[model samples]
Target chain A: MLSAYNITKNYQTNGRVVPVLKEVSVNISEGEFVSIVGRSGSGKTTLLNVLSTLVRPDSGELKYRDDNLALFPEKRLNRLRQSDFAVIFQFHHLLPYLSVLENTLLPFMSSLRPVSKQRVQQARAGLERVGLADKADRLPGNLSGGEQQRVAIARALVKSSRVLFADEPTGSLDKETGKQIMGLLMELHQEGLTVVMVTHEPGYASLAERTIAIEDGTIVH
Target chain B: MNLFTIPLRNIRRRPSKTLLLLLVFSLGVMSIVALYQVSLVVGYSLEKKLTTFGANIVISPATEKLSVSYGGFHLGDMVFDVQELPEGKTSQAIRSIKLQDRIAAVAPKLVSMTKIGDTSIALVGVHWPEERGIKSYWAAANGRFPEKPDEILVGSQAASKLGMQVGDVVSIYGKNFSVSGILFKTGSDDDSVILVELGVLQTLLNRPDATSFIEVAALCAGCPIEDIVDQISMKLPNTEVKALQNVINQRMASVHFVQKLALSVSLVILVTAAAMIGLSMLSAVNERKKDIGILRSLGYGKSQVFMIFCLEAGFIGALAGFIGYVGGFGASFKALEYLALSEGAVPVFAVAHLLLASAVFALITIVAAVYPAWKGASVDPTTALVAL
Candidate 1:
C-alpha cells in the first residue's frame, strides 16, 4: 500500500515557477486497480511520479508500508524500484538494440539478486502472458506498436513486482489494440496485482475498480 | 542478461562510432611506439658515427720544462726529468674508470725518431687492434696492414720522400722491415710517419714498455665526458687526461635534439587522440540520454551507468592498441630505412613495451570517458521519461 499527503511539485523555466502539483493527496490500497483521470496539463502524471518516488515532492509526505519513502536514501530507493516496483511507459521505452526477450530480462539484470535459469524461465512465461512469446527473439524495432507495448508489459511483470505503474500504456496503439492491452491489464488486476494507471480515456478509466479525477494540480474527486 | 552485455550490445549497435574511436586511439599509440623506436636507432647510429671521428680524450705522461740561459745569452727551453706513465699500467688505469663500459677504444702510442737510409722519419709504434678501433674511417690504398714484426706501414708522403712502395724493403736503425702497406694522404702528422708494431719499435728504440700518449674514444651521449676524464685522472695521477669538449658537445647536442623532437611529436599525437576519443564519447552520451533514463528507471544505479560507458571505451582502446602496435613497428622499420640505418642491438619487437603501450592507451581512453560517463549517470530519470 502507498499513500501521499499534501504533495506539491514545481517546475522552474526562464526565471518563472510553474506549479505542476499543488497539495495533491491520494491513497492506493494493495491489490487495487486505480486509474487517475485528467485533461492535458492537469498534473495527473506528476502525481503518479511523486507517488512512485521518481520525483521528489517540494512539500509532502509519501509512505509505503508505513516507511517514509521521501526520506529514503538513493540506494534504498533504487533497491525498492528493482524489487518492489516496476513502470511501463506509453511509448514502450525498450532499448532498440536488445531483442524482446533481453528487454524483458532487463529488470532482473539490474536487480541485486543474481539471475538464474528459473528467473529466465519466468521471464519467458511473462512474455507468453502478454502474447509476445513468438516474438521474443525479434528486436523492438521489428515489432508493431501494440506488440512493443506488450513487450513493455512483459518486462514490468517479469520481476513479479508488488506494484505496477503504467503511464498511458495504450496511448500509442490503435483502438482494437488499445482494448486488448486494457483487457490484459484487467486480467492482471483480477489475478490480485496492484496497478496504478494514468489515462485520459474514460473507457479505460471505467475498467478500474476505483477512479480519481484531478483538475489544476489538485484532486477534485 | 548480465550487466556487461549492455555495453557489448551498444557497441555492436553503433559500429561506425566504435570504429572511429578505435582508429583515433590507435593512431596515438602508433605514434608513440614508432617515435620511441626511431629515437633509439638514431641515437645509436649517431654514436657510431661520432666514434669514427677519433678519440675524444687524450692521456699522456706529465712533463715539466725548465728554461736555461747563459749570462745575457738566451738559451732554448730544456725538458727536465718528469713522471712518465708506465705502459703496462695505462690499460689497467683506463679499466678502473667508473664508466668503463663507455670506453670504446684506447690506442697507446710510442713515438720515436729513426733513420732509414740517411733520412730521419717519425716512427710511431701502436697497438694495431686498439688503433683500428680509434681510426675506423682509415682505409689502405695500396696494400693490407702489417701482420708480422718485420712488416711496416708507410704514410703516403713518407713513402714518396723515401721512394718506398708496397713490398719494398727499408732499414730503420739497422733493422730490415718490409713495406706491407702504404696509407693514403691524411693531410695530418700521420702523412709524415711510419707505423710499426709496438714491440718491434720499442726494441728498436731501446726503450722497452714506454709509451708517449694514449688516445681514448669514449661514447659521451647521455653521459658526462668530464666525469670519465676525472675518473681516468684519478686512477692515473702521474698522467694528464684532456677531453675534447667541442666534439663531445656537438655529438651530445645532436642526439638530444633528435630525442626531444620525437618526444614532443609523440606527446602532441597522444593528447589529440585523447581529445578526439573524449569528444566522441561525450556526443554518444548526449544521444543516449533517454536510454540512460530508462535504465535508471529500470533500477540501474548511477555507478552502473558510469561503468557501462567506461567499459565500452576500454574495449575499443584495447582493440586499437593491438592494431596500433603492429602498425607502429612497420612504421619504425620504414623510418629507419628512410634514415639509411641498419638495425642495431635494440630488439625490433619487445613484448614488454607492447604490453605497456596497450595498458597506457586503455587507461587514457578510460580517463577520457570519465566526464561523459558522469554526465550520463547524472541524467534525471523523471525529466527524461516525462515526454513518454
Candidate 2:
C-alpha cells in the first residue's frame, strides 16, 4: 500500500508562502489504478510529485508497505524511484540527442550491470506493446506526437516498475489519442501493475479503479 | 556520434553567434603565431652574428687613430708591448710559440698624424695581405685588395666622402694612392678606413718596425682570452688584453638581452589568446541556455552537463589551433624567401608555440565556460520546462 497522511507543501515565491497541498491524506493499493483529478492550480501535479518522491512534503507520513517514504534518505528514495516507480510527464521528455531505443534504456545507466540482451528484449517488447518497435531507430523529433507519447509509455514500462506516477501523461494529446493512452494504462493495470495519474479530464479520471478529486490543496473525496 | 551530436546541435542552433565567437578566438591564436615567427627570425639572426664574429678582431691604431676615432671602435683599451714575429719564422711564426699559438692570425698596423689642405688626415694602414689570415675581410663590395705596395682600399663611408670609387686616386698624407676597393658597409669602422700593405705604410710614414697597435684573431669564440691575456701580459706588461676581452663579453650580453625581450613579448601575446578563448566560450554558453535546461530535465546530472560544455570548448580549441598551425608555418616559409641565409635553414617558428597556444586555448575556454555551464546546469528543471 501507498499512503500519505497529513501531507503539506509550501513554496517561498516572491517572499510569500504559496501552499500547494495542506494536510492531505490518501492511500493506494497494489495493482490498483488511482487517478487524481482537479482544477488548474489545485495542487493535482504537486500531489503526484510528492507521491513519486520527486519532492518531499513538510510534516507528512508517507508509507510504502511498512517503509515510511518521508523517513527514507534521498539516495534510498532515488533507488526506489528508479527501480519501483517510473515517473512520466505530459511531454515525452526524451533526450533529443539519443535515439528512441537509447532513451528507453536510460534508467539503468547508473547501475553497474551491463545492458544485457534481456533488458533490450524487454525494451523492444515494451515498444512492441505500444506498436512503436519500428520507430525505435528514430530520434524523438522525427516521430509524430502520438508516436512520441507511445515511446514515453514504452519507456515507463520497459523496466518492471510496480507503480507508475504519470503527471498529465495525455494532457498535450487530443481526446481520441488520450483515450487510447488511458486504455493502455487500464491494460497495464489489468496486467497487475499499479498506476497513479494526475489529469483534469473527468471522463478519463472516471475510468480509473478509484479517483481522488482535490481542490485548493485539500482532497474533496 | 551520440557523444558529438548534442553540442553540435547546440552550436548549429545559433550559427551566426557561434561563427563569430569561433573567428574571434581564431584571430587571437593567429596573432601569437605571427609574433612567434617574428621572434624566430630576429633572434636567430642575432645569435648567428654573435657566434660568427669571434674569428676576427678589427683593430684601430692610436696616434692617427683613424679607425679608432671614427670607426665606433668599442674595445676600451689594448695592452701592447713591442712584440716581434720571432726569429727564423715566417707566417707560421704567429702560431709557433706557445704564447703566440693562441694568436691564429695577425693584421699589424701603424697610424700617424699628417695635414692635408688645412684639415688633418688620420693615415690608417691595414695589412691587406696578412689581414686575410685574421679578419678574413673578403666580404668586400667594390674592387681588389690593396696591391702594388702603395694602393689603398678605403671604408665605404670615407670613400663616399671623398667622392672616390674603385680605381679613383685619393690623397693620403700628401701622397696620392689609388682606391683599389671600397669595403662593404657593415655599420662598422671598416666603412671609413683605407687598407694598404703594412710594410709600405710603415715605410711611407718613416716608422719602420713601429706599430701603434696589433689585431689578432683567435681559434674560436670561446677562446681562453683571459688566460691568454694573463700569459701575454707577463711578456708585455703594458698591454690591456683584459680590456678587449671585457668589450667582447659586453656585446654577447646585449644579444642575450634581446632574446629575453622577444620571450616577454611572446608571453604577453599568449595571455591575449587565452582571454580570447574565455570570451568565446562565455558567448557560446549564453546562447545555449534553453537547450541546457532541456538536457538537464531529461536526466543529465550537473557534472555531465559541465563535461559536455567543456568537451565542446575543447573541440573548438583543437580545430582553431590546427588551422593556425598550418597558416603559421605557411606564412613563415613565405617570409624567408628573399633573405640571404645558409643551407640547412631552420625556420624560426617553434612547434611548441603552436601546441602551447592550443592547450592554453582549451584551458581558458573551459574556464570561460565554467560560469555559464554552472548557470545552465543548475537551472531548475520545473522552471526550465516552462521556458521557451
Candidate 3:
C-alpha cells in the first residue's frame, strides 16, 4: 500500500524554475502491479523516484503503509530502502568492478554484519531465477546488455523486499530481450510481488493490472 | 564486503590512478626522509669537526698584575711571575667536580722560554694522553708523537727557525732531547712551539709539582658549559675557571642552522605531498561519481562512502611511506659519500623512525583526502536514475 498527494517537483537551470511534476496524486493497493505511462519529459520517472524515496519532492505528502516517508530522516529512509524497498534501474547500474553475485549482494553489504551464508545462497538462487547462475563470478562489464538487466533484477529480488520499483527495466535491451524481461516481471507480479514500473510502451503498460497514464505531470487515468 | 575490502577492490580496479598517487607521494616523502637523514649526519660530523677547535674551558691560578707607569712614562706590568698550579692537586680537584662526566679531557701545560741553537722559542710541556683527546686536529707532517719522555715534538715554524729535523737532538736548558716529530702548521701558537712531557719540563724548569694552566675540553654539545665552569670553579677555589662562550656559540649556531634548514625543507616537501594527494583524490572522486551514486542508491550511508575514500588514501600513503623510507636510507649514504663524509659515519636504519614517518605521512594524506571524500559522499542518490 503506497500513496502520494499533491506532489510537486521542479528543476532549476540557469536561474530559471521549470516544473517537472505539477500537483499530482496516485495510490496503489497491496500486491498490485501498476505502470505509470508517459512520454519523454512527462515526469513519469520523476513520480516513480519520488514514490520510491530516491528523490524528495518540493511539495508532497508521500505515505507508505501509514508512515509519511517524506518526513522520515535520511537514516530511516536508508534503512527502509535497504529492508523493504529495492529499485531496478533501466541502465542496470551494477558496479563495473564487482562480479554478478557481488552486485546481487550489494544491498546486504550496507549492514555492519557480514552477509550470512543463507543470505548468500538466497542471492545465488535469485541469480539462478534470472538465468545468470553460471555468470555469478563474472563482472557486469563482461555480460551482455540483456544479461546485465537480469543481474539488476536478481539484485532487486535478493533483497526480498516488500516493494520493487522498476524504471524502464528493458529500456536498453533489444525487442526480444525486452519481451523476455517483461515476461519475468509478469511472473514476479503473479507471485504477489508489488511492482510499480514506469514505461512508455503501451503493450507493457497493458500487461499491468492497472495503468496510470500521466500527461504534463498529472495522472489522466 | 566491508569498508576496507571495498576500497582496496576499487583501488585495484584503477591501477594507473593509484600508481600516479603513489609515485607523487613517494617522491615527496623520499626527498623529506633523505634530507632528514643527511642533516642528522651533517650535524654530527660538524659537531665533531668543531670539537677539534678544542678546550672549551680554561683553568689557571688566580693572580694579580699591576702597571708600573708613573708621570707620563709608560712601563710594562710588574708581575712576570709564573704562578704555577699544584699539578696533582689541581687535576684531582677538576676531576672531582659535580659535572665531571661533561669533562672530556683535562690537559695540563707548563710553559717556559728556552733556546735551541741560539734561537729563543716557547717550549710547552703537556700530558700527552689527555692532550690527544683535546687536539683531534693534530697531524704529523713528519715522524710521530714522542713515545719516550726524553723526546720532543717540534712545530713546523719552530723547526724551520731553529734548523731542526726529526731525529735531531735539541737541547732545552742543557738537557738533550731527540725531536720525534715535526708538527704540521696549525696557524696557531702551536705552530711556533716545541712540546715536551709535563713532568720532564717541570723538572727542567725547576718548578716540580707545578703547572702553568689547565685546559678542560668539556662535552659541551648539550651540556651547560657555564655550569661545568662554575662547578670546576667551586672545586678549585684558588683557580680562575672560564667557559669559552664565543667558541661554543659559534659551533652550536652552525649545528642549529643545519637542523633548522632541514626542518624547513622537510615541511615544504610534506605540504607539497599533501597537495598532490589532495588534488589527485579530488580528481578521483569526480571520476567515480557514478559509483558513489550507485552505492548511495544501494542504501550505503554518506559516512560509509567517506570512510571508503579515506581508507583508499591511507592505503596509498602507507605504501608510499614504506617505499620512500627505504629509498631515503640508501640515498642518505649516497649523499654523505658525495659530501666526502661517509668514511666514519654509520647511519642507522632505525625501525622506530620508519614507523613514525609512515604514520605521520599516512595521517597527512588522510587529512588531505577528507574534502574530496566528503564531496563524494554528498552525491545525490537520485543521480542513479538519471541514466534511465
lDDT of 1 by residue, B1-388 (tens): 6776777789889889777778777877887878877887787677867787688899988888888899988798987765555678898889878899888888889988877778899999998888877787666789989999999989989999999999999888888999999998887688899999988888888888888898898988647898899899999888889998887778788878878899999889888887887888898888888888788887788888888888777777777777898888888888788777644634279888778777778788889889998888888877667534
Q: Tell me how many residue pairs clash in candidate 2.
A: 5
- Give one digit per residue, the lDDT tens place, for model 3 in A1-221: 89999999998879999898899999988899999999898999999989888899999899999999989999888888887888888888888887899889988876446888988899999999999999999989999988999998888898888888999988888899999999998888888889999998898889999999898888888
Q: Over the stretch B208-291, how does candidate 3's per-residue lDDT look in tens digits?
A: 988989998776554567888888888888888888888778877897799799999989998998988889889888888887
Q: What is the TM-score of each candidate against the true structure?
A: 0.77, 0.62, 0.76
Ranking by TM-score: 1, 3, 2
Q: What are the TM values for chain B, all candidates?
A: 0.70, 0.48, 0.66
Please list the Cα RMSD from the true structure of every candidate, rounded to 1 decimal place. 6.3, 10.4, 6.4
Model 2 stretches astray by more than 4 angstroms: A1-3, A56-84, A105-125, B1-5, B8-23, B49-299, B331-360, B385-388
DockQ-based class of model 2: incorrect
Q: Give the TM-score of candidate 2.
A: 0.62
With a 3 Å backbone cut-off (N, CA, C), the pairs that clash in candidate 3 are none
True contacts kept of each: 0.58, 0.02, 0.48
CA-lDDT, candidates in order: 0.85, 0.67, 0.86
Q: What DockQ results for candidate 1?
A: 0.39
Which is superior by TM-score, 1 or 2? 1
